[model samples]
Target chain A: MNEGTTVLITGATGFIGGRLVEMLAGRARVRALVSAYTRTSRIARYPVEMVRGDIRDEAAVAQAARGVDVIFHCAYGSRGTPEEKRAITVGGTKNVIAAARASGARLVHLSTQMVYGTPEKGVITEELPRQEGGGTYAESKVEAENLVEAAAAAGLPATILQPTAVYGPWAPVWTVGVLARMREGKVPLVNGGEGACNAVYIDDVIQAMLLAARREGALGERFLVSAREPVSWRDFYGSYEEMLGFPATVPVRVEEAVEPQRRGRRWALPQLLELAREEPSVRSRLGNTFEGQLARRLAGPLFRRRSTPSRTPELDKLRRLRSKPELPVYRLSPTDASFYASTARVEIGKAQRLLGYEPGYDLRAGMELTGEWARWARLVPAKAEEQQAQQKRKGVEAQ
Target chain B: MMVGAGRAAESLHLPAAAMTAQVTTSVIADRNLERAREVARNYGVEQAVAGAEEGKAFADAAILALPHHLHARVARELLEAGLHVLVEKPLALTAAECAELGTIASERRLVLEVGMVRRRFPALRFVKRALERELLGGIRRVTLEEGMPFAWEVTSDFTFRRETGGGVLADSGIHVLDLLAWWFGELEPVAYSDDDMGGVEAEVQFTLRLPSGAPVEVELSRTRELRNSIIIEGERGSLEAGLAFGGALRLDIGEAPLLIGQAQPHASEAGGDYQNVRELFIEQLENFRDSIRGTSSPLVDASEAMVAVGLLERLRAMREPLELPWVTANTTRAA
Candidate 1:
């Protein structure tokens, strides 16, 4: 974007939208349409004009969209019921589209590759037929894309970007969530993690977004944005495992993992303890009780039942000593297994050809960045200790 | 008079003032007169005013519960009007501003207590006494991790703005820093970093050296749930305490963890028994009132609260972009 360009970003508090605001803050007159419910700490550091309102509010959308050269419609509901998701994804896009059309501004819509649903074994492209029944998130995203396509067809200058498995710093799913699961040693691998992962770094998706907004040819088009090569799930998760200085994750069969979930016995004692440990409200309530105190005392020995030693000889003893006692194994559901087992590689050649978008970060580079953030964020204890040592050295030097 | 009918005022200050026998609910002032009226109606406050200037005339002392940036200016105005002031924490955005307000209050002989209600927590007070008595022996290192999802009902987006003194370090971390200063002696900055890429930081990690040369490692966040506890390792034993007002202190000296001071109903100085945070707020309000009357000194005066603000200022000045290798890698490649 040029210096004089004015842009309004919806979902400016979210991972992608927050990063966009960071990137575009000084380059353009950035205006963020934030919801009151979402914390504005992420975007409040910048000089962006923040307008608090939900995307469902049409008047708020129109007001925020006024005098903007472009509108980046990145806001979509990821939680709540199907109706709520549709209201935000489908309904919110309708409001954004109307605002963009009224203001004669280009619209850059962020869609997901999940819109393709569980595809058959083949390369997936933008021309592939959109599927439904994937889940609420995927279904709603498909509906949102349809609206964007309709708007583009109606002569509104708009482009839709379908990014595959966007992962990097601040990414809730592919980066942070994956690291959390791996750290917990609960990530289940379906078919030994052989499925194709069309993982793209967040920066690459953002680069595609910037290109889509600027290139005239990008209008009236849906671009599939991803890294140049698809990595195996083993490699994708293994990369994070390596970053955390941990051994490989043990793989389990899909059926073996899904059996307990199918029987509705997911909330076992061990899982409940894990949940109580993670949730503040649960911990506060349960921890105050005498039984909770007893359980807290016994939890170490109970969960730390000796298991088969790790296959990795060098790090097995260190891992055993340092890691929390092995909690119950977390298994992937049938849907997650299907998605992880898919071999369809997403094609981003159209984005490269049309918008001149090139994937800047490979999987290794992306994970490296994510690992750096995890360490800085204190998600990685090993790195934190190392950082502490470095800081102590710096202290000595200062003295 | 409560000068800001915002969340802290509505939830804590006004409710605590109603329970404070020495104080009366006089006036509620806010930029939004409707909000002031609503809060005043709920608390049985006598009047509602548009701003602090109008509300200052209604009461002998004023509780400045306004936004962070407005604290210095508004408190200065109230102090100049010969009103005792109990402003919220981080009395001003900078140590200089805090010192200026402290000077104003000192010259006028008005009570200028900062609303650092955590200092009034019985558990923390117990820890302070334990430290003073050398119960944990000589301190070696202290690690504090306090974080939860940002759920405080903020009336506006001021908490996220840098100019408005928003950020995890300045907002919540101030309390942690103050506790360190209160328990330990002076602090020397070692290293500081945060995840601020131009916006207010949701996460921050910093190290400070106590006068005893022991390190204090602090990790604060507004995005995720952390351990939310402070652990002090000393020569003889370690002390672990929860960050919350109701959080208990646990002595880890024995074979098993020993609970020391849990948040039981405790007797206030005013001959009443209350529980947890509400009790602490009441005690703080009482302290403010008594300080104004010269019966007792403020528990946390402006000069004492300035220690945290000064540390904050120094830390911010010394902050390095918490090294995100990936961001650097990408930027270098692009260059």
Candidate 2:
């Protein structure tokens, strides 16, 4: 990638691809292939050529890849059903591979470390075989990697980069998502969050992608890109707690599914009340009706019975319902428990040696920067008192 | 007459106009004649045309729901043709353009209202009355946050482009800024920052000084779900109101929080009950009709709406890139 090199980036509206466009817009002639559904506010600021198209459109992908020297195939379906994910991850990769092959453009595919799945205990590296049944997202990535590898064997210039838990500003999963859960006090820690986290800063991953795009030796190679050392899951989320100025997450144990015991007829009204509380749409719909309004107006006085010496079970249920509903606790699923309990440490020595890639931001530095964004994004408050003091100082200076 | 049959005209203005007995929507116009015809058929309008010029003969008042960039030119045309115009929010892209429209409307003595429908919200009216009555004594600080995932059914890509007056600040910030100006008389821009590199911003944070020198912090976004509420802290107490058109207004003084106002049903002129957002739009339409009929003044006339436009213009002039510390020095140096 040089000053005059023309590159087409798929998923240019996404986090990684958007950042890539920002970094490359000034140095290279950047072209972005964006989907109509995705908002382009993040990347439309740059002087990059935007081509509206989805990766599944072969003609559109080829059109965007035309006259370009490099193709950054970063688009993947993160949402939707399994079939939709497969269509985008596997089928879309097929189209990208075809386009890359036809245009003779160097392809750099973004894969995930989840291809290795929840390995029991080992130093995970690029040489390890990708597991088969690692759920929809991981399986899709594995299948996509297979396509890229097949294309590489057929003499198409391609490089695969598997990043582990990429987290930084604008990161949906590890940064914003974690902060939201932590703020709600719903962050569930499986077995006290003792799992090893191969957390990598987003900029470092972009650096690896750039190196892979430019380095001749990176072709026909797959690299596991991550920070130098792994951090514990507790430490990973703990950094966010420190930024938030309070501890909010709770620890929960992993257990098998349990069936609810049947209750007598007295529990029916309480169950209905719980359901109404859980679903606002249903509650609102019922509340808007004439009967519901009349019932609501009368139910309060009807259920206001004082505790008597011979209280009935129905009265006790009504009294309990009158009290505040308990907040539901977050519990990790079996798969999530297994994922958060993994002890495997991902190694990035291959990327370091082969592509001259070095992690620019360590865990502490990355979290510090992330904290700045979190405050700026208002994910965590920049404390009202502090902001007022700063404003007052600025106001005085202006005066 | 309705110019530009886009999402707002289809869902909001048309439905509200149908409910207002004094207002009759006679014509629907758009550059794309098919869209105009479809909307006209759905709304049961008498005629569809390719441009406002063709539709002007059928109606006395026109609702200009065109894109933001076209508001000034189209409204000027309609006002010059001796028609009352109700343009959508922000009036125009710049404060000067908004002022120019106001000048034309005043010169012709036509009703030129801006569709800042949030001004008609019951909760907002309650908050304004509370402030006027000094219920929350001596306002100290104010913070307003409004955000939601970008899910609007836009007819074109203009909403995401800067040249078309797109961005969260222009689209959503206009409503909030107008509310602030309505509450606390003139706003002076303090500082402005946004997550924009060279394109439109999805998220922005800025500060303004009210007439009393109190700092007003605003954060608007089209990318995430925020608290979506406005909090005004005062020396005596505080008030929190929903940023949405149908949000509740709450007063918090130290004891249990009291809900001052929720979605209360109000009787319309036609003797029908309307509530929440539906009532908001209906009130705005009725106000526009009454302004045209010389029975009442516009809630948000062109000149009054320009206050927000001026503040936005100044904020954009002093805009700084929001600090993105996660961007490595290497990337910055490369750029």
What DockQ values do the models have?
0.23, 0.23
RMSD of each: 7.7, 9.4
Q: Residue-wise lDDT of candidate 1 within B177-221, one digit each (tens)?
A: 899899897889999999786768887999999887888999898
List where candidate 1 sits over 4 angstroms from the true fold. Answer: A182-185, A243-334, A383-399, B136-138, B224-227, B250-274, B329-335
A1-399: candidate 2 lDDT, tens digit per residue: 677899999988888897798788767899999887347766766666778887888899899899889999889988799999899999999999999988889999999999988786679999888999888999999999999999999999999999999998889899988887766534545566777889998888888999999888899999999999999888998898888876654443332110112233643666655654664433432333334455656884643342123235564355334322222234454566677777889999999999989887889988988888788667887866778998887556434
Docking class of 2: incorrect
CAPRI quality level assigned to candidate 1 from its DockQ score: acceptable
lDDT of each: 0.81, 0.80
Show model 2 residue runs off by greater than 4 Å: A45-50, A102-104, A180-195, A244-341, A380-399, B22-24, B44-50, B53-59, B234-236, B252-274, B327-335
Query: Evaluated against the true chain A, what TM-score does chain A of model 2 have?
Result: 0.80
Clash count, one per candidate: 3, 2
CA lDDT, candidate 2, residue A21: 86
